[model samples]
Target chain A: MSDTADLTFLQTLRRVLHQERQIESGTVIYNLPVPFGFRSS
Target chain B: MQFALTEDQTAVRDMARGFADEKIAPHALKWDEDKHLPLDVIREAAALGIGGIYIKDDVGGSGMSRFDAALIFEALATGCPAVSSFISIHNMAAWMIDGFGSLQQRRKWLPQLCTMEKVASYCLTEPGAGSDAAALRTRAVRDGDHYVVNGQKQFISGGGVSDIYVTMVRTGAEGAGGISALVIDGKTPGVSFGANERKMGWNAQPTRAVIFENARVPVAHRLGDEGIGFKIAMAGLDGGRLNIAACSLGGAQAALDKSLAYMKVRKAFGKRLDEFQALQFKVADMATELEAARTFLWRAAASLDAKSPDASMLCAMAKRFATDVGFEVANDALQLHGGYGYLSEYGIEKIVRDLRVHQILEGTNEIMRVIISRKLIEGAR
Candidate 1:
């Protein structure tokens, strides 16, 4: 591939890379494991 | 605070897990027994864009974040920590070049490194200096247009087989500020590699001493300014520690998964092994510890991505906690397997052996404690 195409591809990857969610001040919710024998029937 | 992974992150993790399961898991034992590097398998991973997972795509990388890299590495390590750790080392090398090297140097090396066509090795630890890296004795004296480098780097993965070595050499005086990073071609004259050192684990990758005897390297190959090599190496270690910790997490998790499967089937004097209270407690503890380690690792990785003030401390804490817990979890899994875990065919023994080194390399767990205590004391004042 040409250098320009390579540049474009990398640029796209950079954009995608930095696109991850950034948590600010809300409560960080974790889906903790359910306790043993505590499952609702 | 969002603990859930985004679709892209989850997709990356799944892709890595699938690749590790299919391409690496089956051959792990054979490769370990043969002491083979499996270059082809590693290159296949490169095809998945892992070679430059965090490097910019312009430089032929995936340009992912450190958190993404950590998740992917944990998934990959479910196959084999030895192979995954080697890939982590290579990624560290790639990141160093891209982060510290000039635009010209990045253009020259990043593409090949990102593709794994030219495997890279980081040369930092010397015979006498492992944790105390700044006191290295490798010398690189300035010549007309080149520097005559003469030194030895110990315990370097991909030592002999790699195409490039990102070497740390003493250029100025006697401290961290006097060091320099050089990108030396592996085939350079007088640049020889010692035979691979036989070790207890990590057999799928080669580790050797990189010896330089009056090797002349061009000045243009140096990364960053003079006397900044220590800084560059330390920066790489922050990420390196996380990746190694992630490897341990993956291996321990795999062992736990295997133990869970085995316990459900293999029975003792009772109905089933999992029916026993003691074994269930062990299972519960292992799962909980592994999850805690994973959570801390993710937080540390994200801190590194954000370049937070406590990033280094977080990395050290994560490495220390995760590796120790990982080893404990793997050991418990082995005990749960009874005698079968000790055998090679079961693969639990291999995981235990491989996880053993994570506590030692990339700065020992003891050194991690030192870093953490120092940070804590300073923060208190």
Candidate 2:
């Protein structure tokens, strides 16, 4: 709603994007695909 | 995944903060008013390994990372943005030499530069070419073992005061491809500096036009091969952009801190400013935006460290966003201070002024957008 809230949301989104990109490219620690709605054991 | 500073990074930041508090903050206003460059204080910072924060340890540097440098510059800027920004420019120039210079060149130049015994200036912008840097007109013609350099560089930060200049000169053709990088000794014959230019901010450091009239620079001083100066300069800008943005962040953070202090004590309408909900909301926005900018800057710095393909675009994004937000937040901090902020002694106005040029220099925010969009377009294709 506000610029502050917008930036916070954007930052969270960026982190998620970075995480997804790293996972897709196999740069992250885990090698398995992170399935949607799949909770880690 | 790392959202916080490492212990070492925090220690470095604290060290720089202590130095700024002791040596820089008290005299910042006087330095700005008198247009003084505190060479002694800078040398002291050099003693603390602040001079070569990210340069290699082999050449008397601290061998820190770009991320570490971001923390250092931001901390130093909390004392005075102008001085901190000058140090940033010096580091950029030194890094260009370390990154591209031959072993002999590095051995000769970097040692003194790392110690701040001989300060360095990056000479690229010309009277005709600010935004369009490739169009720079400074010429260097090959003459025996030396290149006869002849042209002027405009708005050089350490123009007259710096001991060496990392200069870009056109050697062959009409465009960027013909340009070559040369290290020119400050006292070289025909090397002269124009009168220091009066500027709106960053007055703590001198800004002047560097003039060269047939100054002979030895061929040995050249960085990399001829025809690659533009690439070198552009590479340097990747890190330079991050440092300048960090400086902006520091200045804004200082202003915000001051505003918080002012609001706590300064009463208005029989109530302290912090008690007002509207003003508190404004403070909230300032802190939020500042934090967001800081986080983005760290991402950019990390990208640079990892040599990521998107490093340049991310740097451009961070620079544009952080500098704009820095100025806005600092300006808002001033607004929160009311009329007191406008006065010189309050220091918030100085932060606002110093952060203004961060948007203009290091490739204007307009150029930043162009760089970002071009990358996006290219990536899509």
Candidate 3:
């Protein structure tokens, strides 16, 4: 849900695509701002 | 080309996600282990208005759009595919009844269905008729104020557990024209159910053969006219296919999420597995494919809501593509997990198993391609 206005299409694609898989050294860091809550009644 | 979801849809999706995570995720494995159909859990979900999501609000339903329902299913499936798929079946029957049933029939069924006080199942596929549904052999002879039905329906989800069955019966002639949609109470006399079927997946719900031996149903239970059952069944399937596709997307997304988490912590060659370019490429491809499938399914759902001429064809295409991609993504996610993926404790293997049937149900993927081809040929003329 982040703004992609400044990034190029390819760059935006990479960032959006790998955002969940971003790793720092041996530790895994999930940068997704959205919580696991997608279920609405 | 609009990728954004409306506020209402997003709210529904989020509510479904929260409910799934709290109610379904923690107990999915247990349900699978015991082969338990959690009717209580399902009823809780229905209390949220998903039971009759697409039905008019005037009839106690949410009156949501097909796209909105698709989004909700995807989010729910993130908790458990089997549970979500069963919910989809319930919605399919509820929608059919609301759309085709007489005003009196709606008054009798929709309130309870909307509240999930009564559960419903669809009876279209028979033992002899799977792909060729038009050739179904279930007969319903009209006898005064009631119809005596003598036939069998197979692969019915929530078969023994459902309270109402939206059934397709042969009423008049042969082929499609003879078919008529009937609402039969599941507890009717002479209506019996076979033993629960053991399947490769979808274990959270029961699948059984519904046997009708001279079951007497009132004439007033018929939906629409007598000869339009096949059309009603097909129309229901158009939305059913989208829901099944959405369930696949949710399963694959879960698998991908698990894989990404595993790759970050798991080590190989004295470094993180995700640091390798080959594995990164795989992750990238999985993400891209899943994203593409989700967006395409949204478009198909929108087309269905619009009642476009090509809605059926688009539904076929979306179901075929999304299910295929979902399976592939889940399989790849399993491979990424190495040995741990095969184990039940990790849950990756469960997603792969659950998603395998999405291609087979709601019409096989091969049938989907055939539909697309036929539509293309017709459009050319």
Candidate 4:
């Protein structure tokens, strides 16, 4: 696994939620940063 | 504000709906009658590549967002919730193991799992631990290379039929700190399956009790650290709730669709049932609530996909609200159908029964309230 290949799960989540472009081919972008207020409810 | 489905989401959704119409709808009535859960149906679904939903492309997967998976479930569930739920549980099991398992573990298992060659179960609740999963007595003591697992899992979805169980057992002492997750293959010695549960509804999906009697799970099978099982399960449930909510949305959609078709032709005191202003109001209400829930479902799922701080709580809210609304809307649709809805042939009855369980499973509505309320009371939640 390359250095970039090992993105932490949360970091990967952040990128997916924040960015729209493909992280790689065929994988759907899953960028969804949870807002803080909703976290606190 | 833009809570609309993208072109891709819409395509997957339509494909799922079409697949269900062709594959699930005709047999749903008979499957319900025989109480035979066709595991092959699920295997065929897994072959679609939606089954490996959350896992990466490298691990025999076509990575898709949780939100996208939710869309698929809702669409299939619109045709047959029993089939949809079974697929959901299998996907749930696959997601956890894929997320936490080691590369060698992923390499060995993900291929079979993603492809639906083998099915997996998630075992957490026990005879004594329904809502209080942490109070579970299933224990796993360290014995060198293997952990000796001894415990019982209750209401296990895909129970006897599953090839593997991603189960939770206590590794340390007591309470939340002691629990850990381990993957156990069905062929393992000392592992046994309890009889399928006879339930109020959702009979087409077989749920049963599972007993782990000195089942030896390799240390390599252990997920996360010794004390991380509770956290792992909690995190999984946060998303699981959302997926279950999606199932509710699907079933509700099915019910509404049936009711709409019925109302257009069925006559009452007037030309047609839908011609009545009262019935029109009811239709309007169901549509309005469903619209709200669909948007909420996607927003919550998107939040989780983003890892937003509020993702978990939003998921809880979405699960609670969507399922509750689904139950109400489905019941009302049944009401609109009158005596015909009660008949098995209408299929509205089945949707009602299946959606009812949505309120209880994947973390009950009560637990959802607790989670939502806890978030409100605690700081930095």
Candidate 5:
């Protein structure tokens, strides 16, 4: 039972990672990171 | 990623499916019409190790994981959602004792509970407190070796028929901090039950108000220390939510399957219903949505099994989405059946009615949003 449950947990993590990759690919084209800027006095 | 079920999981699902088809489906309509709580059928299920699906094996339980429980419940609900959900409630109560009760408490209660010799009910909801569970007023005054319990729990499943009630009561000051959980015997003095409520659905199981007036429960019956009853109840609900969602999945899947079979045979305007492109698209959409909800539910179940930090939030999301989808799909299937679906003989209307309450119980979908949003905002901070 524990082994099956652990395998299911691993599968869930893989699904999450797969979804995150899809989101990341979309974000690269649509949501660029902003750079931090300092005031020059 | 392995999206498919392992061989062991498939075997478990098939076993439950066979039991449901042979034992539960043929009589579900009669049971619903007669409002019968089929203890014999329930005991049969218990014999198959369903009574303590996730409880530790030492106590005569199956000791399966939450994911396995999800699969078992979903398959069982294909036969009758009401029966399957009542079993879920019983397991939740037994698990409380196994998870929190002392060794003696577990020994005294679990074996009988696991074997279905003594059915259990969970007592947390009250007439005054539904969403705000922390506001529960059931009071348990410490008196020597026993706690004198007072106040009433409303809408308790298996209230009159159950042998034991895992109850929550206030022990100290007001609010959530004062609450404590107790495993109260059904035969205890001053413990009485109200009439079985006339409900919208889930008629196969009884729902009644459990009234306690000076009911004496042993101190040993307390699940945990004072001030954590609400916590325990909430924790139990995390898994309870998953099971209920799985029940929704099964019910919807059954309805969808019926729709497919019906459309194949029932003709319209000299052509079969399935021959129409629009109807085919509708069936396609239903199947897609059901699959999506089911996969999401499995993820939440896996998170629970892994004890992930966000398991609770994921559970709320799954419960909300799956139940809503379940209801919509069942209702749509009913529509697809046309006038025949409205008739009791077709069995589609019953599934629609049964799926409706899934949105309300195990914490309302609105409350699910509350839990999910709270986690989201907290994580943002």
Candidate 6:
């Protein structure tokens, strides 16, 4: 629930952020819906 | 071929690292424990001249390149990623205003922001928007000479503390084409800050929602051309992601450095822990992956500096790789520390907690994967 979007982008937006892996099949606009509201403190 | 830090940049990074260690690092535990950082340390940082990295001197800034700014980010995040986030966001917002704001807007805002007289926030991700920013539902309807903004923005870092918000709204039509960037004055009527939401990490800088119920922003507050808000926001965030990745690299650097020092001195089972091959391999992997990530981050920044078509793809890649690497490194450091890593005095647990957010914000690592894979397919085609 906590975010650093205001003072910093240091906290990567949960939706768009991730560890990227090269796709064997080329494509654009990958739909990876984020699991928001998960608190990991 | 070029990865070495410039002389001045090295000096700046060193100074910031020194400041963080001497000032922010020792105090980071207490601040994270209570989730409050002193303003005086930030004020002191402002005086150091690296405060306005990548902004021009004529605009009351240090005029350092994005590369130099990345170095500063990495260095400062070493001591405390939370406090570093606060300072870096100020600079990032300053960069956008300087780059895209009108002369009047710049003259009105940059001096105060650059000099740290006023803190700033970049507001783009709404509750419904997130990665699908083109679908952002925040509305800014024109009424008379001013625009009345309505809707809520979640995950705003300097929400309550910032004097201004670089707000993105739907001004023209629909989709990405309709988005317009506006500089909403913090004290504007109908502009109100939500209570600081207690976050898992980066508590030093408050993150909250901003609600605008017909918040009237002046016509003069618009940045760049009409309906170019999404463009401006995207441009700013490309660099924003790079800087965030730098913060990851920086924090990971600190975590690795600390863990290595800890492993050597701590004796277990009648032997130094560094002699343990399993632990050594983990450290080795951490160091190697971090180096790869750092290389990737700088390469991405350089590509942006060169305005490469690949810059966009590289930004996501660097952000995704560095952040994941950061999380891995932090978690491994904690494991290496065993039970002590979970304790606050060691500060490893806090670093672990802080790094957990890296994979989540500034475009979640999931979205980064999406962006990169999309680019991969398109380029191949």
lDDT of 1 at B286: 94
- Name the fnat for model 2: 0.00
lDDT of 3 by residue, B1-381 (tens): 678975445666777888788889899888888999888988777766677778776566766788988888998898899999999999999999999988899989988887789989999999999999999999999899999999999999999999999999999888999999999999999899999999988999999999999999999999999999999999999999999999999999999999999999999989999999999999999999999999999999999999999999999999999999999999999999999999988988888999999999999999999899999998899
Q: Candidate 1 lDDT, tens digit per residue, B1-381?
A: 899987557756776787788889999999999999999988877866788878876678887899989988898899999999999999999999999988899999998888798899999999999999899999999999899999899999999999999999999999999999999999999999999999999999999999999999999999999999999998999999999999999999999999999999998996799999989998999999999999999999999999999999999999999999989999999999999999999999999999999999999999999999999999999
What lDDT tens digits, residue by residue, belong to model 5 across residues B1-381? 578996447656776776788889899999999999999998877766688888777667776889989998999999999999999999998988988888889989998897799999999999999999999999999999999999999999999999999999999898888999999999999999999999878999999999999999989889989888988998899999999999999999999999999999999999999999999999999999999999999999999999999999999999999999999999999999999999989999999999999999999999999999999999999
Query: What residue runs in model 3 are displaced by over 4 Å at the alpha carbon?
Result: A1-41
Candidate of highest DockQ: 3
Predicted candidate 2 versus true structure: per-residue lDDT over B1-381, tens digit per residue: 879775456656776787788889999999999999999999988866777777776677777789989988999999999999999999999999999999899999998898899999999999999999999999999999999999999999999999999999999898899999999999999999999889889999999999999999999999999999999999999999999999999999999999999999999899999999999999999999999999999999999999999999999999999999999999999999899999999999999999999999989999999999999999899
How far in Å is the alpha carbon of B101 misplaced in model 5? 1.0
**Candidates, DockQ:** 0.08, 0.02, 0.15, 0.04, 0.01, 0.02
Error of model 2, residue B59, in angstroms: 0.9
What's model 2's overall lDDT?
A: 0.89
Runs in model 6 deviating more than 4 A are: A1-41
**Lowest-lDDT window of 10 residues in candidate 3 chain B?**
B6-15
Report iRMS values in order.
13.3, 17.7, 13.8, 13.3, 23.6, 15.0
Interface RMSD of 1: 13.3
Clashes of each: 3, 0, 12, 9, 0, 25
Compared with the true structure, what per-residue lDDT tens digits does model 4 show for residues B67-134? Answer: 88888888788878888888787778887888888888889888888877888888999999988888
Q: Give the winner by TM-score.
A: 1
Q: TM-scores of the first chain across all predictions?
A: 0.24, 0.29, 0.32, 0.32, 0.29, 0.17
Report fnat in order of the candidates. Answer: 0.11, 0.00, 0.37, 0.00, 0.00, 0.00
Model 1 TM-score (2 dp): 0.92
